[model samples]
Target chain A: DVKVTQSSRYLVKRTGEKVFLECVQDMDHENMFWYRQDPGLGLRLIYFSYDVKMKEKGDIPEGYSVSREKKERFSLILESASTNQTSMYLCASSSPPGQGSSYNEQFFGPGTRLTVL
Target chain B: LAKTTQPISMDSYEGQEVNITCSHNNIATNDYITWYQQFPSQGPRFIIQGYKTKVTNEVASLFIPADRKSSTLSLPRVSLSDTAVYYCLASSSGGYQKVTFGTGTKLQVIP
Candidate 1:
């Protein structure tokens, strides 16, 4: 089974504080993603990494950065956390497409609800 | 990336079958339709995926026609715990393809 685990289930930070959200996957998937879920707005992609040291910006990437130093780990960094950044953050990993009928099947962690005060 | 559109919300009774349709009129030839279910405070889980025709699993069935313009997710004998938001997105074939998830349909199961 593919297991994706997050570093925290909940977090609180003050404004302008630096925050880090860690994610790890056991299946050695090549693709990792970070997304933020907000009420009414739905889930918006923040960043994604296709391989080690390779990252791409998603729909909403402002004030956020990502690191993929190894295949099993992906980290999301908040440069200056603000109250508006409070939301549920999700981490997911997946194999490249065309692997089988499970093409692009993303395995997700439980998610971390971050609160910025 | 193909933009997907589905109903905002749906309601079903316990033990009844529920079908939610998602439209991807601009779906590309290499794009695959995937469905995900997410509960409150939890991350979205992959429910089912299909390229074309029909695909069925223990949890749900995905039906896609020849044109591949739309797809329907059929949840059989839904229970109270089946209530969640179902998201449908078209993912292209490749490792670097971008996936965009829309707001998705919120299913409410009533006993």
Candidate 2:
């Protein structure tokens, strides 16, 4: 079974404090993503990394940044946490889509709920 | 990425089959339909996927017609543990495609 693990299940941070959320996947997947889920808004992509040291901005990347130093690890960083940034953060990983494959399913980790106080 | 529409919520009884339908009128030829299940305080998990016609697995079945405008997910003999939010996604294969998730259908299984 594919397993994705996050560093924290719940986190509370003060305003203007730096917060780091870590994620790791054991399936040797090549693609990793970070998303935040909000009520009514659904899931919005924050950032994604297709390869180590390579990152791309998603739809909502304004207040967030990501790091992929190694293949198995991807981290989300909040330069300065704010109340608006508090939401459920999710990490997902999937292998590159193969030819003739119907879909490339993304396996997700247990989410990290971050609260900026 | 293709836009998807699903019902907001559904209710079912234990041991009954549940069917959820999703509409994607503009689905591209290369795009595939996928379904995901998510529990409270947890991340979403892939349930099934299909391009067209019918696809079945141990957990669920996906039915897509020729026009590909809509698809249905059939969950057999559901239980209380099956109560969760179901998301339907449409995406093209190849490379890294950014997927957009809309408000999914929440299924509540009752005794």
Candidate 3:
């Protein structure tokens, strides 16, 4: 079974503080993603990395950044945490789409609910 | 990017069949529609996927029309455990194709 783990299930940070959320997947998948889910906004993509050190900005990448230095690990960074940034952060990993498959299924870790005060 | 949209919520009784619909008007030719179920405090899990026509698995069924502008997920005889947020995703196989998600339909099952 594939396993993805997040560093913390719940986190509290003060305003203007720099925060880091770590994610590691054991399946050695090539694609990793970070998304923030809000009550009415659903899950909006923040950043996705298709390969080591390669990253792309998603629709709502304004207040967040990501790093993927190792194949099994991806990290989401909040440069300066703010109260508005409080939300549930999710990490997911998946292999590249296989032949005859349009979209590869993503395996997600238990989300980290971050509260910025 | 193919943006998918679903209703905010739905309600049903136990043992009743439930159907949730999603729209993806801008779906690309190569894109396929997939559904995911997310329980409270848990990450989403894959439910089903299909390009066109109809496809069925033990858990649910997916129905897509020829135009592929929309799709529906059908759950048979749902139980209380089936209550969840169902998300619709229309995506393709590019190494970096953006996967767009909408505010899934929250299904509540009553006894």
TM-score of each: 0.97, 0.96, 0.95
User: Mind giving the per-residue lDDT tens digits that candidate 1 earns over B28-74?
Assistant: 88888999999988889989989889999999999999999999999
- The model with the greatest TM-score is 1
- Model 3's number of clashes is 0
Query: TM-score, chain A, per candidate?
Result: 0.97, 0.96, 0.95
Q: lDDT per residue, candidate 2, A3-60, as tens digits?
A: 9999999999999999999999998988899999998788899999989999999999
Chain A TM-score of model 2 versus the true structure?
0.96
The better candidate by DockQ, 1 or 2, is 2
| Residues forming the 10-long window of minimal summed lDDT in candidate 3 chain A | A97-106
Clashes of each: 0, 0, 0
| Model 1 bad stretches (over 4 Å) | none
Give the range of the ten consecutive residues with the poorest summed lDDT in model 2 chain B: B91-100
Please give, for residues B1-111, the per-residue lDDT of candidate 2 as tens digits: 689999999999999999999999989888899999999989999889998899999999999999999999999999999999999998667566888878899999999
- Please state the interface RMSD for every predicted structure, separated by commas: 1.3, 1.4, 1.7
lDDT of 1 by residue, A31-53 (tens): 99999998887889999999999
